[model samples]
Target: MDDTFPKIEVLINNLYDLKQKRDGNFEASVKRVLNMLMVLEKGLWRTTRGNPSSFTDSQVEKCSLQLWNWAVAENTLSTISDIDNAKFRHVACKLLTLSDPSSINERRVRLQIEMCLNAAQAWIVCGRYEMTDDLFELARTCIEKLLDGLAGQHHSLSGSKRMMLDRDLFSIDGLQFQCVGSLGEHDKAVIAFNCVRDKLALHPKEAPFLAMVCYNLALKFHKEGKLEECTYWLRQSYDTGKAEEEYKVDSCQQAKTLRFLAHVCLQWEAPHCWINALNAIELAIKEQPNVPGFLLYMKILTLSEAPDTDLISAVQKILKHNLPSDLVFNAVRMVMQNGRESACKTCLPFVCESLSHTTCGLEVILLKMEVALHFGNEDEAKKEAEDLIAKHHSGKMLKEMQQEHMHLLLWGRASFHIEAKCYADALVWYELSASFYAPGKLDCNLAKLYRNLATCYLELHRLNKAKESLSKAHRIEPDNPTTIFLNLRVALFEGDEQNASHAMDCLVQLANQEKDSVGRLESLPAEDQETPC
Candidate 1:
């Protein structure tokens, strides 16, 4: 006898004994067992960590397997509190779920499959995709075994029952594909979909199913910024569903497809993209009227050649829908951006009504401050900015702000300080915003931020720093008129006539190309052209 063997035996016996005496004071007994398990788990973990050289991989795995078995044995898992309960079960199933379905007893195979899939789904809902591949694979293996059995005539499953099994197998594949895609395994996701495409084609009802899968895959690609792949898959989704007439596709699915297509067309800037977006959105609304989709349509129309009256009518129609504060704010922001002050004023009361009932998070609060600032409520905007700064420093925000949102807050505060003629304070905020730059991005917004920082530097008479900021902004967007004009200013300040002449020529060329730009350029003072203050 090993010294550790006796201790392990004692803990195991104690755990079992706790379950045996559960008839009296069941909850208390359960709590005791849970506490003991926690202690044992911690002890085992410490022991393994303390003497890592002494324990081989097999020993560590054996210890984990034993602990999981003890934790889940005899309906013990169900009694665990729902908090972190899904996580616990997901981990417990990792050791117990068999990859080879043939190894499980035939009678328990289906039950085991269901259990594994349910465990996998619980984590998926929580967006915890790690360690789920094994669970999904185990369930898929079991399902495929049953599917294979039917193919070989090993069982007398009815045609409908056989189809049910096929659908189950496909469902697993689709989910796994999306899950892997979400995990950033793009090639693996594509292969998974390709593996099932031929099989799905044999069933007409599966066409819509395939289309939905394509749509989901496209969304994943779109999020990853693989626009080419996203567009290809969207086209596939639309074509597949359109080819199947016997079993009509779901109207909601069609609407989702069309809405996504509209977004893609606009992003891609294809020929007549706006018109195509309008057509797609109109068809989508006809198929399924959803508030978010309708709002997207309104936004597109506002950006188009639609007359003010038509845009105002769209805004009026949108107001009739009871929307969340976020959506109402989006509508107001869109209209305000298009210079539709009448429409914006009409939507203001609804924003107030929605805000009164809902809890304001950082996003909604930020949008509200922007709405106030756009409407010339400078005092309110400044107050809100102060409150945001205090809350951020005190760490009292209800939710963690995302990188982009934090940048937005910093930019807004900097802009406010500039308006107040506090150059040093504005410089601090602007520099802080610049530090939040996301890697591998050279978008127009980022260039504008750099340009704004350069402006702050210029105002404070920091010519060297101003030059550096302008260089960064010019690198991001060389053709931007504002950036070129600022570059000209920087070069003139630095007494670099060569660079100043080059920047001036670029600006003149831009003005020549765009007739309206000439007047705007000439109107600015030669020495200090104000920078969109």
Candidate 2:
């Protein structure tokens, strides 16, 4: 026997004696065993076996099983603190040795894995990511072993043990989904997502888990550019999760899915899809009414090709709810988009008041710039922009604060120049805008900037430079009709009949695809108005 075997036997006997005495020394005995377990856990990291008492692979397995048996007999284990209760410590020690396969047997491995699965769940409940990852690996190994055993025709496990194995398999599958999602392995992520869905199908009562799987599948589909499939799963997630108040599903999740759906719709130029996004926002509000949802909904409604009057009522409701400064700022954007300048003016004071009450000082300055520009008060806009620049340059803001504030300042200046038709000045401001972290990878905005630059060059009759800017815009967005039209004009003016003919053919094809009266009329030449393209 190993030297540590003698010490282990002594500790086991002492623990049994303490249990028998029942002298209110239970806590002390548990702590001692916990300390000993900690020592053995640390030993897994050591390269040298210090003495005969040091636990070998077989002895560790034997002790872990004996410890579980003792815990079953004592019924004393309550928490990880009750290590002397044996079961908890044995599982904990086995988890520590999972990377060292030599220290665990098949049966002990299965028990240890079950215990680690429980521990991992507990850690998840506590929001401990590091511990959750450790326990998750142990659980995964256990489930993989069980799968292998089943494949080899091991004796069929019964009842709770079989259920436990199934649950562990599901959890491991969920973990794999998270791992693949984090690594951006969207293909593998989708496969794992389907596996989870299949697992959940076997147990339909697990609504929360099913919702999570659906949510993940939606995200993976979105990444893969499968818009219809993405929408389907997103709706499934929202529908499944919305039924459970106990889960307290985050409204942000629903809101994000809605927002992404709206974005995909916009990309596809599908007006009906935007209505679906609006519906989703309403559903999200029904689940958990909040300012962010209102803000997102308002933005979507404002951008809809056919704005609904009900959206206006919704905005009024949002304002009545007293949304935060940022949300109110978005409300201002919606109003501006709807050409409700007076409504924007009315909301200005409330926006300023909310900003003053918050610690986000620079945001207030930025909002002032926005309101000024919206109201055609260029002087006020420039003043706010200069003030913000001075404040940031004087080290009066945090690094993050400065970075955020500078972008607003630059954008305000850019908008001012663009509206004033001072395209040279606009180019300078846009160059500055390029230096900031774009909030949404706004390639559309960049494309617009290039288009504007191209227009300015065209005005100056610099056809080469105009072509260069238009090429940049086209590279960013190949199918934008406006860019195509502009490029066609450039070709015509440059007398490149071949290029002009090609651009016209593309425009005619797009016009035919639209199947609208205006599109057909636009495609016809001035003298050929009676003829179709």
Model 1 per-residue lDDT tens digits across residues 1-533:
12443354455466567667756675566566455545544455444443323334444344435544555564355554442444445444442331232332443456556557766766665667775787777777777666675557666677776676676676676667657766767678678777666566656677776787688778888988887788677877877777456865777888889889888767876557778788888787777777768787876787675666666666555556655545555666787788766666566555555464455544445665666666766567656555555554565443434345656656776767776878787776666556544456676767778778788787778888888888888788778787787777788888999999998888789988997775776665433322322
Q: What is candidate 2's lDDT per residue for 1-533, written digit by digit as tens?
A: 32544565566566667767776667677667757755644454353343333455665556655655555556544423332333354444453352344332456667667666655544444334344565677677767766666656765667777787787677777765655544455567668777876776444556576667677767777788877777766766766655445563466666665655555565565677677777767776765568767776776677773344555566556657766655665666677667766666666665566566566566667666766766677677667766766665565553564455555556556656656666676556555444342334446766766676666566557799889878887888897776777787788789999999998888788777775633644573321101001
lDDT score, residue 496, model 2?
95
Off by over 4 Å in 2: 1-58, 62-107, 115-158, 201-240, 243-273, 319-333, 340-533
Would you list the C-alpha lDDT of every candidate in the order shown? 0.65, 0.61
Return the top candidate by TM-score.
Answer: 1
TM-score of each: 0.40, 0.39
Give the C-alpha miss distance for residue 377 in model 1, angstroms.
Answer: 28
Candidate 1 C-alpha error for residue 470, in Å:
48
Q: Please give the RMSD of candidate 2 to the true structure.
A: 19.4
